[model samples]
Target: MDVAVEVEDLWFTYPGSTEPTLRGINLRIERGSFTIIAGPSGCGKTTLCRCFNGLIPHFYGGTLRGRVLVNGIDVASRSTHELAREVGMVFQEPEDQLICLSVEREIAFGPENLGLPTEEVKSRVEEALKALRIEHLRDKAPFELSGGEQQKVAIAAALALKPSVLVLDEPTSNLDPVSALELTKALIELNEEGLTVILVEHRLDLVARYADQVVLMDRGAVLVQGDPREALSSEEALRLGVAVPKPIRLFKQLLVHGVKLARPPLTSEELAEGLVEFLGRHRG
Candidate 1:
């Protein structure tokens, strides 16, 4: 197994904070897998993501214990610039990450900063823009675009770096439902293209549909991490305020109502097919 990220007994604390934000965290992410880190507010999801990109101990000053390796490089030993090339990050708010004047400049900023050849930067910018389907907005000012458009531009900028792993924190928190769906589809497409994606999001339904693994956290500790189906179906997930997909909830309800199904459905499509089979069996 090609490992993209590895953390062992990680611990972190902010200046003047009474309690540590993370405690003895251990996690490993496989290359090319889509994983979601989910928890309620203040559960250290964002803090853990920052560590993945070397933001916690590097950017923030505090006592750090443990090791975080990204693409075989120890995060604590690598500089922020070096880590940025290996792990691209997209924040919850696009405006927070967008510093360039236009979409094209924003996307090209990373490669340019790395001092790549002009042609290479141009090629990467074009590819990133095309991948996100935001070529039409290439010339538009970052401030002038809609929330979804801004997020797409942010993701494009991250992609331009060509990082082995992409870490996104609440990418869909501010978007409308339609925009959220659009962003989710784009993320799924990126994951399909072999980019390792780690997202910290509260929207369970969106991530449940595509996430290969799910990490449920609480009180600055990992509660469970495994295949999304197994982890999300556990009772601990329900007790921690993590939202369950509607299909799974519905399946459980039907099971309680005497409907016999072989497995709990994870998506609407699965639920529909299960219902069809159940009806067919009854008719027979």
Candidate 2:
């Protein structure tokens, strides 16, 4: 399989900190996969993302020992300008990343920085806006949009760069529940369209239904990584404070209530089917 990101024995520490935030971490993400990195705060989920896009050892100063490769280029060796083409990062706070006066310009900024032709940039800007279903907000100032709208605009901006991999750090952290769900749906659609997505989020319930792979981290180290079904089923995930999907947890609880099912259900639809079978078997 084509690898979109590779981290080998990666380690990093901030300037003032005596201990390293990340330690000997290794992971590989396949191209076009939707992967989630989930864990409690300070577990290095965000730090690991920085390495994926060359922000750690490049933009932030620290003692770094390891190799982080994105799209086959070593992050240590690539400039931010070079990495921007292959990897687009959407920060937790959109305000920190947004600078363009209008939503359209914000989406257009990255493509413009890549020195894309005026016509090509325009095409990408339009396509990105359409993809995120935000074309209506094009002419409005970014500051005027709602939190969810701002995030969509931020994502649209990242998309405009046409990156092979997109890393998002808690993209839905600041939105209302409805907006969060909408953004999650948009991200799932993007993944279906074949963009490799790496998400760092605490909202496990929102992502559990859509994630192909889950990477559970703790104290800057990977605790588990695998298919979402297997990974989320592990006790370590719960013990580490990684958010558990309510449906999956509810399924497990039903088992405690003497309900029997063939398999643990991860989605509401599956859970409903399991309940039907359990009730029918008990009735018979």
Task: Please tell me which predicted candidate would have the highest TM-score against the true structure.
Answer: 1
**What 10-residue stretch in candidate 2 is worst by lDDT?**
258-267
Please give me the total number of clashing residue pairs in predicted model 1.
0
**TM per model?**
0.95, 0.95
For each candidate, what is the lDDT?
Answer: 0.90, 0.88
Local error of candidate 2 at residue 194 (angstroms): 0.5
Candidate 2: global Cα-lDDT? Answer: 0.88
RMSD in order of candidates = 1.6, 1.6
Candidate 1 lDDT over residue span 171-263, tens digit each: 999999999999999999999999999998888887787888999999888889998877887787889878889888888789889896666
Candidate 2 per-residue lDDT, tens place, 160-223, comes to: 8889999999999998999999999999999999999999988888888788899999898898
The residue-level lDDT of candidate 2 at 178 comes to: 100
**How much is 217 displaced in model 1, in angstroms?**
0.4
